[model samples]
Target chain A: MLKSAKRFALTAALALAAGPALGGALGLGSEARPEEVTAWDIDVRPDGQGLPEGGGTVEQGEMLFQERCTACHGEFGEGAGRWPVLAGGYDTLDSDNPVKTIGSYWPHLSTVYDYIRRAMPFGDAQSLTADETYALTAYLLYLNEIVAEDFELTKENFTSIELSNESGFIPDDRPDTPGLSEREPCMTDCKPEVVIRMRARVLDVTPDTEDTSAVTSD
Target chain B: MSTSRKPQGGTTRRGFLSAAGGAALAAGAIRPAVSAGPENLPPNVPGWSRYLGSGVDAYPYGQPSSFESHVVRRNVAWLTASVESSVNFTPLHELDGIITPNGLCFERHHAGIAEVDPSDYRLMINGLVDKPMIFTLDDIKRFPRTNKIFFLECAANSGMEWRGAQLNGCQFTHGMVHCVMYTGVPLKLILEEAGLKTNAKWLMVEGADAAGMNRSVPLDKALDDCMVAFKMNGEALRPEQGYPLRLVVPGWEGNMWIKWLRRIEVGDQPWHTREETSKYTDLLENGKSRRFTWAMDCKSVITSPSPQAPLLHKGHNILSGIAWSGRGTVDRVDVTLDGGRNWRPARIDGPSFDKAVHRFYFEFDWQGESLLLQSRAIDSTGYVQPTKDELRAVRGTNSIYHNNGIQTWHVRGNGEVENVEVS
Candidate 1:
């Protein structure tokens, strides 16, 4: 009888919380334990909100990167094949072949630590300790000439070290373009001359159709 | 499987043509107007009519006709380092109407497909919530459900064509987008169940994939239209499309729709994750970049009469294409046949849903002259799809994503089509 009374009270609370407009909650799902939230809260913000207590040096990062990342990111973070280049490319953002690297393009240092901590080491992810991630981030900074070889990175100084392109990003201000007119779009004689500026046949970069496996073979 | 014997000396029209020789086929000679004109005519019954068909359960789950086996997703190998972390293009030229079939939706995986078992799936809501909650797949289903049709488009759909017309087919140039009807519960109900705190302004939704793909979304948008979808087109979601459950951020770039959804953390500030920073962010030519450019601009493409689907006849051709907008429904689509010399409104023939794909077509009589075909889309916002040159003038050629420029297809007199750029 006492348990039945408690259930009735819980249902009443749920209905009041949901409000009449929403028709009340169905009273599903269990309250999550503190341990469950701790296990999944891995994100780190620009203001160093979720960082753990850890520190590592650039020397340690170099060794760790060589052992775990060089196969894909290259020995000096120059990148292998189409893999991401983690270092250098400080001022190439405006050039034709803009090589955006950690030092050049990334705005906040927290992203480097978060990415390495969440998903890194290529095939293997979430396998690194906080110390290892900090070390790898410091090593990348040193490789990009942002830090000295002996510089160490810690949670306390994580926000102090800013990336070069921190001021590069702006909010989306689209429809900022010109040429779109309020008048009806041109239908007849929009351009005086029609010239073929480029053709895909000339470049011929499309994959060969013959190489594609036939679906019927399955 | 061998239900009948082969007909003696079965000389069908196609068989007769093939038996003639290579020269007859190469020169485009002796090609009948209709392939089934000979034995399959009304006077003589076709071979299939005489034979017994396959019994029930031949395929427990049905498949497309074998004749349409060529319709399949394709990928450009050199675009990425490995197949595990790459993308594939949908066979857009072969598809019609607005709904993309389940299997043909283009896939872009950061670290391959994660095969998650339904029994093991769990979605947790925590951080800044009055009461943190953990729910199994069954628990999520108990909430009120809604059905919405929305198009999920990768921001890099036309990214490769930023500089010029490089890819030969529409499949490569504009196949990174797909439309589907999703059935799921409104994310607001789930968040309300967890009871949001006053400080909750942003949400960090993370997936359970090996890449652990995550993105920060403003709480306003989450409450407006976001969904926790577990089914697509009235069926359970495909494994590649985040089986069990996935977040649906309608009208936004596809990356923000985190698949294999696992957790949602309410926060006060954006996380600035790798996807938002190191990638997805548009790099302008002036060294400044555009971050959080979420909504896909109004875009359209001529699916047929493209490089892959060339013109086969000289008269009465139906030019078909697709148009969509991330902000709202497509309002109008215009077609140009003479390199912008003349334009006419194409007939939109399907149901118009907000932030969903719209199908359009223009029927014309072709007289075998060379033609330059282009289609322009205008959305509810009156935003006209810009020309490649016009877009280049503003954003420059460096911003690889969101190249919603009008595409040009050159149709030769020989009934062959080629991807081209016009000035």
Candidate 2:
């Protein structure tokens, strides 16, 4: 540990000494900057945090979806031409072909709302206003048959909407002793009774030839 | 004209993984060398350094090397329903300098990539919050933000191990992992804006893809350092990389970071959905399931001198590999030639970015002997790399994800390599 500390100290000293020279070489790129590089995350938390004040209705959302989403999602949100079908998929989790969509598979209504507001309208974005976003959320829920066509989704009625898959997710419980109570943790010298090395046959190269066409945009 | 022939117009390429052979290999031999004198060379430019684009050219977006036209993210044609639903690995043997060019990073998905525009993107926060809020992409950018270089590994990274040794090099064994610099607004800031209700303990994040994949994240970790990220390496993310936005969950499995991020519903407990309950979880020998295993434990793999990286230079070869831990930085790495019979410490190179990739090198002289090469990495928390059988003993053969056992490579005097496990 002491030796490591010494090495770290020496490295730090060298960096400090060369800071000016490096800075001089990178003058324009390194100089004068505020913290404002634009995080632009726009992530809204559960408590109504980070939400824009604007609001939209289900009617307005339908119009926006018709203009931008119909090409891929189909007019009724069933999906078109190699795209994933977005509606109807409730309670098909255990089936051979599980239709995992917003109505049947999504665990929370907030997620549906959040996803549409942030990512919907596919290629053309920011064209939907707050009310339009809310309306679109309602339209998606309606298309999934989760809500009635008359259902209104706005800031006022947002919290009441629930998702069918809400109870499917569970919190992480790996490190707890009680969780692993059936499994014993070695106390004394925990040397292995036997050792098996990694054999080359365990490596997989099939992926080297795999085509990555559908990998979603990050 | 043949399908291979083209107009030779400038083809827009993605990531450029300079084949391990090209990493400073010729310095100036294979590729044009840097002339010592300014005018001595006829404006002799290098391979990647040939195209001289200004910083502004890379401002909005940066592409991979022009020479690396073949390197790309590809999915197995037979794996899924269509091209959009399969996955692909990053060109592990083709990369250099640790920072994987974002364009060539590997991708895994149950559904196809979702195309999300940044303009209409919004995040909804509700459930156990005092006041459920909706924020636009603009609002998310307003909070305090931070940056981190981290390796996101799929739990199914070495899932193929469940069957047998099928691949030759580490590129095939563990290419699912990638390390990159992420810039975003911390989840804590967003949660704080929503004002978590006293009972709020977890946040369920969902994606906008047709599959609508969702997972529950613990609120404690969320508030600590989670990020709603929008950019990777210095540019807006690629369309396949959750374009425009994604959740950045450091040190955790890749599944939790929802792409085309849409919502965060705070709640009192985990939702226990199909992904968490049926798919991602591991089923052990016993009937029980190893559910909710979020953290990707410490793992390591020797990247160079493997099957793909044939023994070019006979003597005094420098072996290189990468080791990382979701818990913290890798403290040490050990390399062995005769399996576990003998081991030596490897030199850790470059900065040990927390939860990021760490490079290690070992210089050894060989007289052309047939040998088995293996590397074991120990993290700061003292977790050591396990053996293949050791991991199989506990998890059983019917499992995938989080396979970080010690990897071995067989080397022949003829300079060829093959997959071989030395027990």
After superposition, candidate 1 runs with Cα above 4 Å error: A1-24, A178-181, A210-218, B1-37
Candidate 2, residue B166: Cα displacement in angstroms equals: 1.4
TM-score (chain A) of candidate 1? 0.83
Q: Candidate 1, residues A66-127: lDDT per residue as tens digits?
A: 99999999999999999998888878999998988998899998999888888897679999
| Candidate achieving the largest TM-score | 1
Provide the lowest-lDDT 10-residue window in model 1 chain B: B1-10
Model number with the top lDDT: 1
lDDT comparing candidate 2 with the true structure: 0.65
What residue pairs are clashing in model 1? Answer: none
> How well does candidate 2 score on lDDT at residue B202?
83
Give one digit per residue, the lDDT tens place, for model 2 in B171-280: 66688889888889767656666566777788888776765667889887886668988889977877777877899898999989888887677777776555665457
TM-score (all chains, Cα) for each model: 0.90, 0.63
- Kept native contacts, as fractions per model, are 0.61, 0.15
DockQ of candidate 2, scored on C-alphas against the true complex (2 decimals) = 0.09
Per-residue lDDT value at B392 in model 1:
90
**lDDT per prediction?**
0.85, 0.65
